[model samples]
Target: MEGPAGEKVPSDNQVKTFERTATGLVREISAFRTLVLDLMFTSPVFMFVFAILGIGIFVGADMVVSTLLALLIGFTTAGMYALLSIAYPRSGGDYIFISRILSPPLGFMVNFVFTIVNISVIGTEAVWVSTMALGPMFSGLGAIMNSSSLASYASVFSQPVYIFIIGAVVMLVFTSVMFFGTGPTFKIKSVLFFVAVFSVIVYIAAIGLTSTSAMISNFNHLSSTSYQQYSGIVTSNGLPEKFEVVPTL
Candidate 1:
């Protein structure tokens, strides 16, 4: 019986089916793909490069201690998210949980702000890809090929217009992949993930074989930027010539 607006509301017995039978998306993403997606998001290369960039800012901070603390916190937070996912099987993500626990408006507001923040960070991340990944790749190739022009272009990632174009191209590529739909997107991501993994392996092998002096020499040769200049930056920042614990974070 309905009396509020003289309109009838369906009882549990009367409401047996939904207006729409399908929930729009088919769950084509496998467990492996899900893990791949997460790994791509948490790629250590990006984190390492970002930390390296922030070294001057965190000069006084203990590198080992900071790294350990970050790992501890990150793991704990991930564990909590995992537990929550297991508890709330079908429903997921920050927004879903927040909306359920708190008010939807508050959840929406928080998620919306975070969405904007993530979108804004896209350009920076793209620039990082240009500088950290492509620049390094080009430098390594230059050293191998003995091409000065190739080496010169290694530093091109720093140019404002070049970096902007790199960022824009990266955005466009990803957006185009998204337009192809989720299944194709994950497939493409999987390919990219393996390529990144291989690159990481090569990087680790190269680092293991090469000395610090050699790395510096290569950098100087490629970019025509002196190691002395970088050292000067540290010195001018009031950092000691020899730091007991060099902070990367």
Candidate 2:
């Protein structure tokens, strides 16, 4: 074909094959490691607090049963993700799978929205981690040292500007680590995963060793105080007149 400048342009047959380079990442992660990563992605430790606030408050006694049910549902969802991973076997994951099997337009729309949401949420997550995790750890150190001022210093993270700055710094650090390569990133993640898992196991063991009656009594006492404080707001919203604790063993 003739170019705009009257130069001869190469036809389709002249096109060269694009070569894909080796990323140098070995498939070193084992099944257990993959399971831990997947589980961490799906159900992070932060979600424990969310579940407590969302379901545990009302279903205090039955929270264990509710959690078990949720775990069953999570397993089913994880199975679906596994199937998709096997079918696609690519990094694009759900987007590529859906685009190949279904319509590209639908896949694009789904992924585009998801990408936007995910990107937006990273800032929130960074801010939360800084304020909730780091702040608490610093405060705990302050407490151990018997310095109230040091503990109060954590309040700086609660400021909007400081939160944004810290979140941005966190994003930059992680992004840099990822740019360096997955090896270091995964190593850090693995360490964090083990620590989180150990913490969760210890927490669960403590809960298991506690007496059921004691738990119920504590829940009832807390609920009674909260109910009295928020009864007016609850009634205005057409909620229950009183907080009722679930009766489950």
> Which candidate has the highest TM-score of all?
1
The positional error of residue 137 in candidate 1, measured at the CA in angstroms, is 3.5
Model 1, span 1-249: residue lDDT tens: 686999767776784422323456536578999999999988866655655655556766655467677898899889988977876665577777677778788889999999998898887788877777778878878887998888788889768888889989999999898988888999999998999898888867987999999989877875555888977876897876654454534
lDDT of 2 at 130: 67
Measured by TM-score, how close is model 2 to the native structure? 0.65
Q: Native-vs-model 2 lDDT?
A: 0.69
Give the Å shift of residue 49 in candidate 1.
0.4
Q: Report the Cα lDDT for candidate 1.
A: 0.77
- For every model in order, what is the number of clashing pairs? 0, 0
**Per-residue error at 125 for model 2, in Å?**
0.7
**Reference-based lDDT, residue 56, model 1:** 56
lDDT of each: 0.77, 0.69
